[model samples]
Target: MNLKATLEQWRMFKAVVEAGGFNQAAEQVHKSQSSIHHAVQKLESALGLTLFFNEGRRVTLTEAGELMYRRACYLLDEAHKVESVANSLKSGVETYLRIAVDIIFPPEMLYKALNKVSQDYPLLRIELMETVLNGANTLLKEGEVDLGISPFPLNSGFSEDLCEIDFIAVAHPSHPLHALNRVLTLEDLKGHRQIVVRDSSTERKAESGWLGADQRWTVSHVRTSIDIIRQGLGFAWLPLAIIRNELETGVLKPLPLEQGGLRKALLFLCFADGDRLGPAARAFLGELRYQTMSLPSVESIAE
Candidate 1:
């Protein structure tokens, strides 16, 4: 039994179980409240237990300090991602990247691949994050982003495809389904009011391209379901490159759906490994695959 626990006594027992004691974990680890109570009393006397209990001045953790504060927060987040990939390979790049995207992925090809990675990595630091459907695969499965375009195709990392995205089903040129729009159907959009959007996945909640209308309305951005269907307050399905100027000037119209109002999607591009990416996430994923090969596909949005 020679353990001698340390990562500075599991970072002073996770800063006194997240600063609830030892004088606010010695003012949050700046040390000395008698060195964070002698490093959590030498990590509970080298793990013989009794992690925390005193309630008078508050400090509660105890079931072996909630399993050693969830394994010392996964060993201090894998030792801060091994000191952030050894300071991004000794500062050759990636001082920050993040990404995430997917708000129908095509804001002018993500502003021309972030204006050519800010004129070739002008000191990295990107971040971005938009998100919507599967919300960029829930921020790349919660590593909280480091590249993820997404539309679907993720089942565990390194995807690619990257493009497609059409959708249409609009409305609002004086709504009332554009005055009995000639092609409209699904029982004339089951009594109007659809909008939708939502699904930013906290863990589940998804509903894509809804038709279950019974006066729907959800909305959580796709530019707030195209500004609440441009104020006519309904009919949604957007992203024809974000309603190409509300379908060119008429301020939105397209509901001629005798079957389904367009649709396409695709998109991909995820990450999580591309050889442990860096150098500004491999130069903004080679300018997001050379500006997603000059977009406009899905048979040019079905003509």
Candidate 2:
């Protein structure tokens, strides 16, 4: 069967939709606007479908466009996966590895794993992105990261239960909420401010943690949220992995809640395409698992 449209045309079409217009798509993909326009026109002609209607400078997808867009995305993803699989089989150790890790994952463990793996492959490059919430999952799905440590229910890829992060509601000892000197409730928390870490994903919908308080501040990192909390401005449910020192030093104190003071997020080790994993990616995964095996949880890390 002969197909009228090429993957490049679909790629161009997808890029135009994502970038909002042909001109933007041109800039994004490093192609001229004329070429993008021609490709999209050709795609619509071949399929006999109207994919976009243009505003002054923007393009909006028609209903049929939306349907084709989704199918095109899937097609493009599968095409990339096939190329990756072929490359893995023919190539030696990958020269570089990209990993996306949820911020809640222990930094020490990551550093140790990378260091251990790098010892054997001195020239291997690593790109480590510290993401929040769905960020790692999105990166893995988009094939941006070869590996990831992210919360489960991923849209794509293979995942295994890895570890859990213990989050506790905490605030500065000087904050008025602590002055009550009793088990705190959500009602009590409502009067105060809460700091939350922003999700790093670009396209898909993402959530900042619990918006429990009337006043809220959103930041890009957990450390930023912790820093604001330490300043007596707000309170938040923070992961214990990074806040242990602050807890011991009295820089922060846990909310005395009757119930629901703590929460847990189970993270998983995800592969971008597990069966087609390159040699370096495989080695890195093995080293990461080996390093994580010794520490069961944050409680065990302290021991």
Candidate 3:
């Protein structure tokens, strides 16, 4: 079969269908209108069917055209995937890194760490998938992502505790709870409206299954939740790393919780038989550990 010819015709037909006319398709595909017309004509002849109903200035797909469009789209997408894989193999470029990340590392920290690693390993490339918890476990186990940074308890057997972020409840100084220095009991917060960022995963167990869940308002991200806390909307549990600036500036104050402090365990994960992290991912993770103060000794959460 003339595969190249079939592909060329498919391209022309798709361009015409998407661009709404032969002339427009020519402009988009950088071919002459006559060339596009000829290609589509050849395609129809080869398929033994009329693809479109010709009406002046408007072209509508025939029944066959509709069916072919669906199939053609899948074919092109598969072709592109094959091409991408071929190029990666030929050039020896690492094409994708499926990663799971805790929302704990805000954008700035994540970028800085990645930047440092990219410096030494220029050929290394990445496609990162970020999630708050174990959402990316399936991809990691299936070897889709090279590694994932998630919180414990991890779904995969091959995992290591990479970081720890102490959780601190904070509120504005003028808020009534501020005078208490640190109200270390749950009862202290019962009377005041609380703000929380909800996480359904096991890592978010701190806030999960709370009978007091209704007393607090929920926000989607830490930054926004902290912003509301600054405005004195309510007190919230936040990572100490994230609130350091606010604490120093007196924009926010940590409340005394019942426990000495709330802490969370962060884990780095890979498939049980996965290869060691490439230079880039490894370098980035090393920097991440340093920046987040997660280094020195890696510890497991108490059983």
Instruction: Highest lDDT: give the candidate number.
Output: 2
> After aligning candidate 3 to the native by TM-score, how far in Å is the CA of 298 from where it should be?
18
* TM-score per candidate: 0.42, 0.74, 0.57
Taking the tens digit of each residue's C-alpha lDDT, what string does model 3 give over 1-303?
A: 555348788988988899888888888999999999999999898888899987876578999999988888768866765775566556553534456666665556677787786676666676776555454465565456666666654464477666666666678988887777755677777788777655634433344213273367876567778889899878877777667767777898767677634655555644433334444556666787676663222122211
Candidate 3 regions off by >4 Å?
1-93, 106-109, 138-144, 179-184, 200-214, 258-261, 269-273, 290-303
lDDT of each: 0.79, 0.85, 0.67
Worst 10 residues of 2 by lDDT: 294-303
lDDT of 1 by residue, 1-303 (tens): 666787878988888888888888887667778877777787788777888999877689978789889989889877877877777778776667788887777788788878788788787777898877787887777888878887887787678787787788888889998887487788888788898777787877886788888899886778878888888888877778767766777788788787678888788888865655786677777888888787664355445
The alpha-carbon root-mean-square deviation between model 2 and the true structure, to one decimal in Å, is: 5.2
- Where does candidate 1 have its weakest 10-residue lDDT segment? 294-303
- Full ranking by TM-score: 2, 3, 1
Residue 57 displacement in candidate 1 (angstroms): 37
Instruction: Tell how far residue 97 is off in model 1, in angstroms.
Output: 6.3
Q: CA RMSD for every model?
A: 13.0, 5.2, 8.6
